[model samples]
Target: MANPGYCVKNNIYETWKNWEAVNLEGMKEIGYALSGCNQRFLNFVVFEGEKVSVNNFYFIAHPYNLELPVLCRVFRIQPYNPEMELGRTGPLAGKKRRKADYGKKLEYIIGFAEILGYYDKGGKWRQMEVAPRPWDSVYEPTEDSLRQFLLCQQFAQNALVVEIGKVRGTSIPVYLDLNAIARTHTFVAGMTRSGKSSFIINLVRASSNLKPRPRFVIFDRRGEYGALMKYGAEVIPYTEFMPAITNPDVIVGKLELKRTEKEVVLSAVRMLIEEGESINREALYKKAEKVAETKASDKTRTKTLENIKWALDNKGAFIDREKKPLDIISQIRKTPITVVDYSVDTDIEAQQRTATHIINHIKDYAMAQRSKGDFACIIAVEEAQYLAPEKGAEVKESSAQGEAKAAFIEAISQAGGYNVGLIVMTQRPAYVAKSVISQCNSVVCFRLKSGNDQEAIMNYTEYGSERLAEYLPGLADHEAMLWGMAIPTPFPLIAEMDVKEYPQKAAAFAKQAWERMEEKVEG
Candidate 1:
């Protein structure tokens, strides 16, 4: 509720008549008597009109603020000059002019403020439809006046609320809507050691405990999520879940088979199905070799065979005779979190192939099961650059594997409406696919050192601008600027990850564990 009586004892800024932005002179000394408040660059300033009319002027509120979040960013500053000053014509002439105009610079500080929003009759802060009437008494919003801009009904409910950070001034905990993540997708960006992994872990822990817990499938590139296994996150080796070639699309799209080899794969799968045999690497390889002998040229045959052998060697035992194809969505349904660790997968391409396959399957499952209500999940892909590489780069989109990965990312981004959230985290934002980043509705940005990466964030994500970009490089570890639909308002926050919550690095208990080990060894 808006307390009109929550007044400030001191707010003495008065507007000048020549405040029209159209006229250069009119903008000069736009507001005068700028005194009293300890105003900063981004503070809320309310202009009080003579009569209290509905159109009198109210600004929209930032969802984060508990009261009114109408804030103006102080962009530029200049001297307040009411009239053109000609150098004192003469000492006597200066005295005759007036004491106020004689031998004095302007007393008022002139600065331009971008009107953010104002409070409406319902006490809800709304965005300003038009510029406020100029020459009114401009007063800095009192702290109490600013508190009424709490999150609206759209955010306060149906949100997976967790303490992400604290509001700038008060100890009030700031929360994010995890539901928004599935609805619009999220981007977690930072440089190395900028707490990107920590943030992910924190998020996983939070989401794991939600009322109707959302499934989390993390693509653990560097095995960072091994610590999160205690949170019911099953850490499966990449080899254990090498995608079976159940779908012909997997062979060409994910495995990156050549145009010629695609036919060999199709023939192989057909042969296996005819024999009522499960799709396995050995069967597929044998069929490819058989096809190579007749249809493929000697050069093409050798390369095709070599590619098949390389995949089998690198991706290890994808064909389980009895076991069904590894369904990531099924695992997610049973467990809150599933981490597919690629630490053992030395070949980068092999890792990409596996990830591409998993993402595709999950997206398909989520979209198909959208009406089921129980099929909600979030896939947090670490080292997302590899999965969704920028076009024409080292991992060009033209490449078979790259296209598959890009396609999967595109699908997940597009399938947000189907309750499938893609949380992409990367150290190098510049390399991540532009389409993927652009699709993200929420952005949790840690420190970014590279100008290219910073520029990418500004270009792709929401509320990203020069002002926000300026803070990226200087953010402390664990601190980030949280923006987008997930949070009520975009603000800098220190993500809290209690040591107990991340028991993976239980350093305090290491000594006790060592003692137990010594006792067991003696026994």
Candidate 2:
């Protein structure tokens, strides 16, 4: 008996007469002769059963075995036409025709799904590595059939869900394995204003429901991530964190300072500790300056004191030196979020230095806490190039900044092992350190205009070739290409973003701030 899952199409094989001529490997070539149907590339096609049953329950009850119906997709298309015969003496008889014949036949060649496995009657997916038979009956997959065919067990019930982006065409909500993102690193690449920030905001919102609630440490370079801080993340500035730092070596090393100047600061702290002289907020700089005067030149001594004062003043007057010291690891483990805002510094290098310090501190802390078992945390770097640049780039490979950045580059290269994952988002993938981009386990890319940007993505991913790379320039707003180990196959997706899910755009706040002055005047 035929299964209700499939309709009987006795003459389906007849339409596949051209299959033998173009069938190479497992791809079947079918004629474009359907009266009302339109065939598109990448769309699913199901091979109908001639004397086979597709009902899952029917196969479960009976021991008789039959091959399951094949699911395939159109990969390529070609048109063939015969040239008209011309008189023997005609001048154009030997010339090739430039236009295609409208009446000529067109054929499409389809590649079978690279099936990893299939679900059994007992609800377990079994492994079967094979392709569809040649000249099998093929039909357009119905919506329900397509869902069942492409639907993976990972998307089924009880899995830790992270809403990635929606599948193109249908409203199917695509999900990411949150465990996978935490285990393997995720990289996001797009041009400026391509909705990368909004996509990330949506991802953070999705993560609110996870059990145990994984920790997140965000490096906000442009100060655009306040929406997350408002969502309960602890916002800390570089100078605010300075008060609690037991070792000033890590902080001073990255700040471009002369050797004598560094020793001056170091010696001051040493003298104060040895003599039991208590160093308070006001006396700290004075103690360090007194040490500089003893061995430093008059010119160098003055510069050292000025540099030390500038470091303290960098955070502006907002920071309270007497405020309780912040323990980042303990705070992250408790609140599970920490936002390092570099918005105070207008210079890019200053921001980079601060981020480098924070990342190094987090990496060391996470490694230390690993012995306690499963101490996983994620660090999201906004402008990743500064922290992890390729060799020969501007950031020196042997400098303190480079060494700090290397710690992260090394962690990501090891596939986020030791329970530390990295999410590096950049508008310029080409500028981002190649070491970081190459190690990404999964990549989410939005539309990029530059050829170099497209090429950078192609270099990192296996499925993105020059032909498909062309799609990067034409993707609709909010549309992106998601490829890598996280997905079963490379998919073109439309990101699901709800402004209500987080804060509105920064422009909205800027407008309100600008109009507030007028309100006071009117009042």
Candidate 3:
């Protein structure tokens, strides 16, 4: 007996003819369901003259059932030729068969798809309880039908939605739930130059345009996001916006002060606060010298004074002596987008301290805002691996860096209650803290070349199967797989990111600078 999975030749021809007669204009009869159908997977064989590609969406319809059609995505395709396979191993093992013998008569295409469930009457995707029977007709849905099934129309005009890109090959706009992203946090990871940064820039622009816009505090490590100033963003240098010291012990911990030195520094900070003096580098150094003179021996005082002076001189990127500290809370409240440009500061330890300090302040402020009504803000951290490195990784991290990582992880875990969101973007997910990535409810992944990095992403998302990881290294630029609460469905979808034009490229700026230097030489 013939296999039950395949339809008879005549039956397939008749099915195609009947489908055409029905005049379903855009819907095309492409194939028939085959034997391996199940609740989670569908196997089908394509008819002659029809084509299907990986990642394409198709619908399977039952002959007698009137339920909504099941939507599935093609992930694998192979050529099927049972006769040719047998002929090669049978009598024709040594003899070469003429190409004209079989022609295309025995050739067929097989497709393996993952069932993406079907949209219910209310337009929500639900799991499939039953699989389509063998020989059932498979259809390539029209663009309109696919869009409607994906619920693209509902979010098109919604103000709270932010359009990141389109469904990979279609014009259907893919939107993310802004509220969900802000409250639950998001993780965006990819290799360098894989369009992760561009996606974030677009997100910032979209979020800024919304009414009662949530504040955006972007820690721009590479100084790239300054172009957002054209979109009404306030780009401030890191040195100008450092926060004042609130706790002496915290500062001492950040400085990694020695046992004897820690007391002198702590006493100095306390004296500065008590005497109503601004705790800048010079004032702190002066107060520390006085404390060392009063409590230490000559040998101890010399070492203590030298340590304090060195710390003030070298690790003072976030310290200010004369000028009043900028009110960061007021700045975040007033500006729609605040970019803290850290490109100029090369002190890694100071950067960590600054990040930790600012995060603590934001957390406190966010809590107060949430008490009144709906208030939201996003803290987008670029190059997050440096600030939130995994504990005891290859690179030895400082105590201050550990504090920064802790603060970020804490913020991510408790952000929903405070309405403060965290967007952690990194080129090296392997180096970043797993806790930070795991807490984020949404993820946008671009091409990742490292197996370790791919494995890191796999730990957090449900779609991170071995087969799915195989696709990560090959994803094109500007294309990303989006999943989790921010998206419309639980099944991940690849998006072609839509980024707005910004200022001149970095290369152009460098060329301009070289030309200026040449002119100076000529003069």
Candidate 4:
């Protein structure tokens, strides 16, 4: 039998056929045809992998015919045939193959006609050698790529929808999703107030609305994600999610934290909670010992220490109008888009430190996942420099914010691949670490006014083209240059996504704030 965990990618065509059959028979039966304008395929190629199993790929024809690939990962590669025609004899013959399927995170490699068939492994200059296919109606869809999709389907069942969108009534509908251009990661950046936040919201909205809703855990720093609740998303605040170690008993109880290279992850957990002014918390923690007396109520003792730690840290964080530190527990338990709103968090240094506290908390949780398994989490940090900056900047790690930035960057940059995907929005792309931004393959870019920001974006992408370079500066509000898993090639699109669940338009508050100021002036 075929393994279930492999993946295949396909692009959608706007000026081409409406639908294509799933298998070879189905594709022909449905009259699936290809157009030259929006032709599919990418000339880009990553690392060359050895073809170990013949059943390690597939042809996915998903519902609604959306443009995205399906991922099929082979865990137990049983004996199979090279031709993939099935009914073959080999060692451990007739045994079934199994795979770990990921239909949600599919990276469709689009064929850039500008860089088609260029395989010189040198510098960026090699990209220039690939010749662009003519914008004509004579191009044909590859029976080869489709046949490869069929061979891949022997290992995976992810629905791959091929799409190629093109301009109306003119140019060839090009084959956008190419085979050679392998899976590529993306990073998006723009100047401040350039609608980057709005672009992110719209992108996630598209991902969530897929045939089967995608489960994403967003680490919201600005509290702006409150609108994503309509998708039935589950949001967990960094504060209250710590039911694991609220007291000495829970820490000493059945749970075990994942270990890191630093070795002080456990100590950091103690400091965030019951440690208090007493330095002995680490000693107590190392021994996994309860209090000698064991007379104090666990709830009362835990609460008191928690309050003390809050009081000390509160001095460094923004206080509500009622003078309480910005607590994330209440909001985390409420929605999937857990908003750790640091918008009012004015003390740049202090806010960064608080984010650090959350980062340490995430580290502990991730460590716990060693035996616990993937919890499916994604952490997003808006205005990332405030939380995860470098060591020698004006904001020194000597301060709490500086300290937080350091830890947040460490946790995200190092731990992101292990059940953690970091999402950050910043105007000064220069300040954000190269290591952190480079990891993001899915990037949505709006208008960037600075040459430095533009230059940074160019360095982190594999889809750069002369036309795309020209279009970068021309992006308007609601118009974005989206890259990565969403679309094929670096195409400009008019995003028509709504403001999630906010429903009615948010009334402008400028008049109200201005009126209050005027009244004070008159008085």
Candidate 5:
């Protein structure tokens, strides 16, 4: 009745029509692919009435030539006109009429885009080997298509996604893969008040919604993360959250004891632990006195004891007997988020020692959990520069700080396998330890004003080229460039989501204090 070849042709047409209905609908034609296009990059000339922009996603519509449209991101744009010369003082420009029209109608844009591959029938992004044909129509993807293009569909399907913010210039939400982030640490850097802390807070809040939620241990140097309590976090003051004293070297480092003094202190701590006594300031001092009496001359013993007493008086707040000791590890396991607030403590060395103790304990816990095939937790370090300064960067860094830095470095390199993630944030990227920063697999960079800091970030991320670096200083507050394993794209400019203001107790204003003093004098 009907020719078999004709029937096959009709079936092919019907199939293409169905695919076009789903894939081509709502795509706006903006340009045509130019001749210089390649597998990795696309060159296009924008239509006279249409527009294109940097960082926007577009697709080449060539259904017959390719099974699916190829997605690309425009990264560069320039104005061109064949009739007009751009050079002002050249002989060719001078010969042309001075009043010649350079009107909008005569100008068009030349767009350069990076080929970001195409989705296969299984909804996976696969590398595209074939380039688009010259003169093929280029269209701006619809919002839904753009979302499909930018997200890792497999990760999204598992609900292992957290919304960090919206894509810049669009309302489309951008999500990070939680599993990727947990497997590979993230580094966040920016100048103060550049929304670095706010971004971290948002990430923590979003992560709380996932199934089989991972715990958060936040070392909040400035006490800012207390607001997380509203989301079911336990904010423990630094003085009360005492980790078990498993190592005497921690105390020796904190005190910065001399050679003889350090040995005596270690002996004392060992004796206290072996006897099952609480490792408080009083017990430690008594044990040290006994060790000194047995080993040192009267003059040397006197000096060592006096030095130990002085150091303890100033930096041994954690070992104070009056404060009730809470087991930090137990809290970490039970709580969804545990924040150690250090706003009340001004001694930096003491803070370093405390952080070292807690980190060591967490590391051990994570390793144990890893053996059981359980994911442990994420540790967020705020003001990381103070605790993990670059080697020899701070002349005043004590042994305590050095130990803290070492703990962070080890955690960054080894903890991912244990399902422990580190979120290392700093206002001074140049001051943070290079080894620690280099280990982070994802980067969320905010506004940075210093050249050294920008250079440091450039070395860490794959997409941090000179052109991208130019955008750093001008980034608006809460705007950041996100790249690496956590996100699907190589890099994307995102407007960080707004977070609720946290509670911060304001200091007494100078004027208010002075007026109060004057009133008291009048009284």
Candidate 6:
């Protein structure tokens, strides 16, 4: 139940023209305001059964600088009469005696229905505080919410807040509207041990259940996403893609004086190895010229050569001998779920290269499907830090994981309106390239530490630094602040994380165990 009333503004001297017309949405605001009042005002004066026709459009100016600008010139106002005194209260704790100052006229500007945004009165007409609603990828979304997400596109609303896991008492779920993910590129970032991983798991699961399910693929470096196996996602381990003599399509290549592309491919067959080498573009054109002078290689030959030389044979795998779509569509029609699992123990070069191969393959797949007709897809990078490495490290400057992540994001960001979506999740946010964040339209922010992580989040997100400063110290475990165009609001909002289902993550209290160790040491 909600309280309801008409909007009345003090600015009006004669004409109610500036006064917005009343509608259901405007009524909702009035209801909220009146419901927030004490129950004792249940029998106030005015508006019970008045037969007055209400207007529904109004102009909004900055609540602060009256002349600056209007938040929105005009929007429909939803109005409904919640009797005269809109309210409901459980038990009364205390109450303030009424004063003559608050007269009986229940008229005031209900709200800027389109700006359900957090607006501050007196701040600016266009700047009144509206509610915050963020996008929530973790939500499986009821039929009701989906319709709301689509039809409510232009509604002035805030980011949604979703609380995960619940106790009978004390633990209220945190919720954030993450509607931005659907419209633009998005990001998920946090520090190690924060709830970033758990939150990501839930997000993937929810995305899997969309109306037209999204084809989801994940880069599971530590095999953390093994849990997703049950969700029907296909896992492509390094072993499966490694070409061998047993596979008729594969052949060994002889090493040349200087590394030839063939030798590099064979060496990388076991573990896709990548180390960037400065090469001139003219050389590639010249090499193509030499190849063109001869007959164009057929598909089998091209694919085999690529597999033997490079870890990635994307298009070659799908094109036929004459450079046409293959009669057999195994590459495109197999499984919808793809998980490229790497090991935590693997060397940096190997893991980075594997991630690159998978990303390149996905990029190609999305492009191919679009040129033809195919299912739309979403590629999720779980614990992306392993693949999206930090600035060049001596261990593997060749990986240039940072550069790889940027490339991957750029490719997918361009696909959103086309036929693809990208979900990038990471525990060590700093490891993810700054450029990648701008490519995502949605985000699921879990608990994060370090100003660098917080600052990076602020740059491409709607969450403010002031809130970042306040929330950083109090990120209840895996919970995050989600914000982005993929979500609903233009503001940052909270999302309670759901990690209780992961038994592997559970453990005894650490502080108690540490205390026992200290006692033993003293003894």
Candidate 5 per-residue lDDT over residues 195-243, each given as its tens digit: 8878878777866766657688888877778668787898888767654
Show model 4 residue runs off by greater than 4 Å: 1-186, 204-223, 229-335, 370-372, 390-398, 464-468, 485-512, 519-523
TM-score of each: 0.65, 0.63, 0.80, 0.49, 0.75, 0.50
Report the C-alpha lDDT of model 2 over 1-523, residue by residue, as the tens digit.
Answer: 3321111111222322212211122323232122222211122222222121111100110112233433333322222223433442222443653433432333222222222233444434354443323333343444444444344333312234455555555555555655566667888888877777777666776566556576888777666666775567777775555333334454354344457767876776667667776544345677877887896888777887887777656732322235754566676778767777666665444455456555566667667776776577778887677777655554553244555566667768653666677888888888777778877778778879987777777887555555445456766666676766555333333344333343234565677977997888899
Least lDDT summed over 10 consecutive residues: which range in candidate 5? 3-12
Q: Clashing residue pairs in candidate 2, if any?
A: none
Runs off by more than 4 Å, candidate 3: 1-26, 62-66, 80-107, 121-124, 152-159, 245-320, 394-397, 462-467, 502-505, 508-523
Which portions of model 6 show Cα errors greater than 4 Å?
Answer: 1-126, 129-183, 207-210, 242-333, 371-373, 390-406, 462-464, 498-500, 503-523
Of 4 and 6, the candidate ahead on lDDT is 6
Please state the error at residue 392 of candidate 1 in Å: 2.8
Measured by lDDT, the strongest candidate is 3
- lDDT value, candidate 5, whole model: 0.74
- lDDT (10s digit) by residue, model 1, range 1-523: 3211111101101111111111111111113223332222232222222211110112223334323334454444444334435553434454678455543443334544445454443534456554333333333333333332322213533556555555444444556677788888899999988778888788777655556666788887776777787778888887666654465665554565667777777777777778787676777788778877876798778987787778666753544435544777678777888888887656665576677677777778777777776677788888787777777444644334655566666675567988888888899999888888999988888889899999999888876666555457766677676777887643323333322343133344788999989999999
Task: Write the residue-wise lDDT of candidate 3 on 254-289 in tens digits.
Answer: 676877788999998899889887777778888888
Give me the candidate number with maximum TM-score: 3
Candidate 1 vs. true structure, TM-score: 0.65
What is the per-residue lDDT of model 4 for residues 1-523, given as tens digits with 9 covering 90 to 100? Answer: 2211112232222111223332323221111112342222222211123222211222222212222222111112222224233542322242546321232123222222221211111211112222223331112223444333222211112432222222211132212111111122235466655566664554455444344322344445555665665656544443432212233222322122222211232343454455453323344333222331142355554543443344324431211112334334333334444545554435444355456666676656666775665443455566666565534444652345545656765775555444555666677766776665666665656666666666666775544433445455655554445555434333323232233333112344788879988999999
lDDT of 6 by residue, 1-523 (tens): 1111001111111122232311112221111222221211111111233221111112222333333222111112234332223352111111344332323233333322222221232321222442212210011222232222222223123222223433111243323223334335557777666766566566555444433344556666666666666766666665344221211123221112123344333343322213332222222223433443332345444544444333223322211122222211253256556666565455454455445555566566667777675645556677665555456522343334554566576665576664556677776666676666666666766667678777777775554434464455466676566555543334444545656334133244889889989999999
Clashes of each: 22, 0, 0, 55, 0, 86
Pairs clashing within candidate 3: none
- Winner on lDDT between 1 and 5 is 5
